[model samples]
Target: YVVEELDVQNSIYEVPLELARQELDVKTLDLLRLDRRTLDLADYLAWLDGVLHPTRECTIAVVGKYIKHQDAYKSIYEALNHAGIANNAKIRFLKVEAEELEKGDPARILKEADGILVPGGFGGRGVPGKVRAVEYARTRKIPFLGICLGMQCAVIEFARNVLGWQDANSTEFDPDTAHAVIDLMAGQRGVTEKGGTMRLGSYPCRFRPGSRSAELYGVSETGERHRHRYEFNPAFRARLAEAGLAATGTSPDDRLVEVVELEADHPYFIGCQFHPEFKSRPRKAHPLFNGLVAAALQHRQGR
Candidate 1:
């Protein structure tokens, strides 16, 4: 359409119809067309307009180890784009290497970000950096969103800093740590094979009545997809809750922690065990990503 100057920018369906009439000499193209009212393209055009020309802008620093690979976090990047479109803001991604954060000062490396996001990853290679990034987001009052391993990092950071447990860590990194805020799922303790053994697929999650997560989702119950084996250790849940990291969302039976958030005065700080980005769409952004983008814009304005 852009090349041919066809009046099909409104609806993608128009492109083929126009091509048939203009080039292929299809006389019945108009008759074959569906009712215009049934195929309204207004909403699609509006969404495209927002994408082509966003009114606002904010930088979200994505702290992760896979910064070198473009497609490593493709879904996450697209989810952020969808969220930016919904908010009428252009997302400026500040891709910070997790290792770099460990080597340099986090505040200086992340000073330009209006929000900080720690994405999922495995192993202990850049975990300390991820934890440091979470700490930066927490203490500096920046809008933050953590997913999977990122969420684990948040819990570890809170346990060590706020809960005053210097040795707080995930057993995945330090099995001998005195405080294992994040640990392997009970069922996976004796598993020999690692392949195809993760807690995969959709699972029901119930949100706390007055939590920020529930407010953003506007629903008490929903299904989020999971792809990890390690989870928030239930053994430490009570102590963590006492120190103010509330597990706002959990499994249907309330046994597994699905979401955690700071209940205090921070504008927006939440971490989810599942990858909400997997469900985000261009026209219908996922609630969590939308919330993060909205909060990021607010933080930018405040600054």
Candidate 2:
């Protein structure tokens, strides 16, 4: 298996995915465009109106490793744009180095970001910076999102600080830890090797009652695509909830943790194991993302 490392501060680590032994094997994150799948103009226009704001705009920073490969995250960035069409908010993708925030003030580089997004990545090298990013968002009440590795970092930050899981961490990075916050599925096949081992494509999520996700999707259950190997270890979930972390959504089998949202008291903050950006379309923006952009606009509006 192969592992791709991306960093965020407050913690640093690596993910060792089991990919094929082939030397030429490389797993690069993809960028899919939303127009390819958007079938309705009315839907698109309606969606656009909600996010666009020209006279007044909100600056959103997508902090990640592949910020250079804009095409790879086309759907995500486009969805942001589609949302911005209504609010006239100019969405900007920033190639932020996770290491820079490791011991520095995140506000220095991230201060202007009305919304902060930490996309997926592999390995331990950038985990700490990510945790620090989450902390910065939480403390300052900035709209924050964690996708895949990003999701794991949020959990780790809460586990170690609020829950006091001093040893809390993903075994994929540190197997010797006593409190393994995340781990590989025992019966997990297809992904026994890195490329094919992770559960990919679309899957459904059963949301808890009265959830913003449920409200956004207009239902209690929703489907989304995923690309990851390690999953949230349920053993430590109780601890996370105790620390005010809410497991807002879960998978079909209830074995894997798929979505997490901060308590209602906080501003818009949510993380998911799956990439909602993958399935989003220009006309039909995913609710999670729409909510995120909306929250950012509201932040600037002082509403």
Point to the candidate with the largest lDDT. 1
RMSD (Å) of each candidate, 1 decimal: 4.4, 15.2
Error of 2 at 216 (Å): 1.6
Candidate 1, residues 119-236, lDDT tens digits: the string is 9998898999999999999989999999999999999999999989999998888999989899887778888777544899999999999999999999999999999878999999
- Residue 159 displacement in candidate 2 (angstroms): 0.7
- Backbone clash count for every predicted candidate, in the order shown: 0, 43
- lDDT values for all models: 0.89, 0.74
lDDT of 2 by residue, 151-230 (tens): 88888888887777688889888988888888877776334568766888888899878876777678878888888888
After best superposition, candidate 2 residue 289: deviation in angstroms? 0.8
Best by TM-score: 1
Tell me the TM-score of each prediction against the true structure: 0.89, 0.78
Off by over 4 Å in 2: 1-53, 68-72, 86-88, 189-192
lDDT of 2: 0.74
